[model samples]
Target: MPIQNPLKKGSRDPYVTIAQQQLIALGYGLPRFGADGELGDETLFAYGTFLVSQGLRAPTDERPKSITPAGTAALDKAFAALAQGGSTANIIDERHNHPHSGRSVSMPYRPWPKITAVVLHQTATKIGEKPASWHGVPIHFGITRAGKIIQLYDLTEVCNHANGLNRPSVGIEIDGWYAGIEGRPETLWQPKNLSTPRQPMNFPTAQAEAAMTIVQWIVNAVAANGGRVTHIHPHRQSSKDRQSDPGSLIWQTVGLWAQNTLGLSDGGAAFTVGNGRTIPEAWDARYTGNRY
Candidate 1:
C-alpha cells in the first residue's frame, strides 16, 4: 500500500513504517531512532531535509509537519530512481524546461568519452530555486542556495562555462557570493565604473553536501555513458578573471574534498590553462606558488 497522504506526527499508520524504510534507503538517517514507525522529530527532520535537498523547500523554511501528495510523489520518484541504480542525489532535471540560450550555437556536441572533469563555480550572487531563475545562464548544473541541484543542460551540450576546458568538462555553478579567502570581503561589478561591496557568505553545509553528491553523481553518470571523470577543478584554473570564481572556502570544502575523497585531481600544483591562475597556496598547500 502507498503512503497515505497527509501523514503527520502522532499518526500510527503502518505506512509510516514503509516511509521510514524508504527514507533510510534513500540515505536519510533516523540514527537516534531507527524506523520505529513513529513519525517523531527524527523522521520529520529527515523528511524536511529531503524536501530541502530536492529544492521543494527552503533551508530557512520551517520543517514540514505532514507529508503531502507532492512530497509523497517526490519520494516515490526519488526512491524509484535509486532502486534503478540511478543517483539518489537531489537533482531537478530542467534541461528541457528552459531554452538553450546559454549554449553557444557554434560549439559541436561533445562525446561522453571526452569528458574528464567537473569544474566548480560560484554564481557570485544568489539564484532562486526555480529553473526560471537560471534563464540564459550558461552552466550544465546550478545548485541553489537552498541546496537544490538544477540541471540546465545535457552533459553533451558543451555549454560555454569553463574556457578551454569547456569541451572536456561539465560545469556546476554553486549559488551565492564566496570570497577567494574566507573571512575576507568581496565585491561585484555594478553599472558604470561602480562596484558593490559585499561580505562573503559561508557555504552552507547543505549546499556543500549537495556539491559532493552531484560530483559523485557526475562521475557515475559519465562512467555509465562510457566516459571517466578523473579530475575536479575550480573555475580559477581555467580563467584569470575567475581566480576567485569559487574562492578558497569552496575549493577547500568541495574541490579539495573531491580530490581527497573521490580520488580526483586538480591537474597538479603548476596546472593552469589559458591565462588562468593556479590554485593558490592558501587554498591548498600542495600549490607552493604565491597566492594570486
Candidate 2:
C-alpha cells in the first residue's frame, strides 16, 4: 500500500508500512514492533531518528507528521552509507586487546569479574572528538549521533566509568553531551531533561533508539557469557562524587523501558525529579572542577 495519508500516529496506512520497512532495513527499525506498519511510537521514533541522523531537524512531538521529499533523499543517503559496509554495531578486534593507542581511562578496567550491572555514560564532548584526554574512552561501547555503535574496548574488562563500581559494571558511552552543560550552547543529547527541568538536551530519536539496542546487546552478551545483569545504572546513579555523564531523564526512560518491556532488571532509579539523589551538576570533571 502506498502512503494514502500523511503518516501520523494511529494510522493503518500502507505507506506507513513501507516507511517502517525502509527504516528497519537501514538499522533504524523498531525492536518490539518490527515493521507492523502501524506508525506507532516505536515506528515514528525510528522515522524521526532516521531523519535527524541525516542532520535534518525532526520535531519531538508524538503526533504524526508528513514525510517531505527531502526525507526520501536522506533515506537514499542512509542506504548508500549502509551499502558501503557502514554498520551501527561493532566489537573491537580481539587481537588488539592491550588497549590500542587512541586513549585510556583513569585506570584500565579490570576484565569484568562478573557483569552484574550496565552503567551508561556520555562522551560529554562533541561527537567525533576524543573524550579520553579526560574521562578516557572508559566505555566498552560508544554510540554515535548517526546511530552507529562503536566498541571502544572489549568489555570483558572494567573501565573507570563509575568511580567505585568498575569491576562489576560495563560502561557504554553514547556520543554527545547531556543538557545543561554551560559550555555547550547546543548539541545536547536531549532537548529536555527527562528527569528534571534543566536546560534542554535534545537527544535525537535515532540516538535514543541506538542506545536501547546497545544496552540490550550488552544484556544478551552477559547472559550468554554465564553472567546475568542484575541492574542497569546510569553514570549519574553511580557517580557518587564524579561528573554526571548520562544525565537523568534519558537513563530513567531507558532503564524503565528495558525493565517493563524487555524484562531486564531494574536495580533501582538513580534519581527522580526533585528527588536529589543526583550530583548537582552535569559537567564532566575532566572539563571543570567542582561543577556543583
Candidate 3:
C-alpha cells in the first residue's frame, strides 16, 4: 500500500486512502475513515509502521503522529520495497539532504496538474556547480556519490534541469558525471568528480538504495497528484540534443528499479510529450529491453 498524503501529518494530500486503511487493517492503524484524505489520527499508524520498518521501537514521542524527516525516509523505504513487489523492509537506509530549499508546488500540468513522468539528469556541472541559480539546484533531488539524496526544493517548484518540459515532470539529478564515454558535445568539458576505477561511473550502494526509495516516493506522490507522469526518462531526452544527463548506470539502476521492481513503464523508452523525450536516447538505446 502506497502512503498517500493523509498517510502522514502536515502532508499535501492522500490519493490511496486504502493504503492507509490497509495499514490500519494490518494493525498499522492511523485512524478509521482515514480516507477522508486529511492528516489526522490515522497518520500515527503509518508513522508507527515507518518506525517498525526502520527497526526502531514504536513511537513514545509526545506527538507520535508527527513525522520527522527520518520518519519520511522510513516510510519511503517501506513504499519502495512494497512497490517493487517485495515485503516491507525492517529498516530503510538513511538519506542525506541539503539544508536549504525552495518552495514546493505540485506539477499542476499545463492541461492540469499531474504526474507525467520522473525525469533523470546528471550534474553536468559539479555537485556545487558554479553559476548557481538563485532558485536553488536545477534538479528537484540529487544523489551524491556518498549516497546522499539532496532535496534542493519541493517537487512543486520548477527548476532549469528539464528545460521547457518542466511543467509535467519531476526532475532528479544524480551526482558524478552521467555523460557517456565520449562525453557531452563540449569537447573541452569533462566530469569534475569521476569516482575510482570509473568506466560507467556507477552509483554507490548508499546512493543507489536511497534513489530506489525516493523514486518510489516520487511515483506515489505523482499518483496522488493526479497521475499524469508514470514513466522515467533521461534529461537529454527532454531536450533537443541540448542535454545528455543521468547516464546509463542511473538508467540501469533506477530504471530497472522502476520497471522490474515497481512494474512501471520503460524508463529507457523515448516517451515524447512535445519535442522532447522523457529522457535521453543515447543510454536508453543500450539499456532498454535489458534488465539492469
Best by lDDT: 1
Candidate 3 residue lDDT tens string, 1-292? 2332323465544323323422432345443543344555556656565576567655454346554555544544554554353323122222223333332344332432555667777665546422132225655676666655555555565545675557656777766655342233232225458464233343455666656767777776666666645666666566655344565556655664576456667543435544654443334433345321
Give the top-scoring candidate (TM-score).
1
lDDT of 1 by residue, 32-139 (tens): 865566888788888898999999998955667887767877776665444234467778888888778777567757889998999999998778777788967898
Residue 202 in model 1: lDDT: 61
All candidates in order of lDDT, best leading: 1, 2, 3
Q: Report each candidate's C-alpha RMSD, comma-separated, in the order given.
A: 12.9, 12.4, 15.9
Off by over 4 Å in 3: 1-113, 128-135, 179-200, 225-228, 266-270, 273-292
Task: Tell me the whole-model lDDT of each prediction, alpha carbons only.
Answer: 0.77, 0.56, 0.51
Candidate 1: C-alpha RMSD after superposition: 12.9
* lDDT (Cα, tens digit) per residue for candidate 2, span 42-161: 877777787776668765555336655566556645543432332234533332444544323554434443778877777665566333332335556766666666665666765655
- TM-scores for candidates 1 onward, in order: 0.68, 0.51, 0.50
Q: After superposition, which runs of candidate 2 have C-alpha atoms over 4 Å from their true positions?
A: 1-113, 129-136, 180-200, 241-244, 269-292
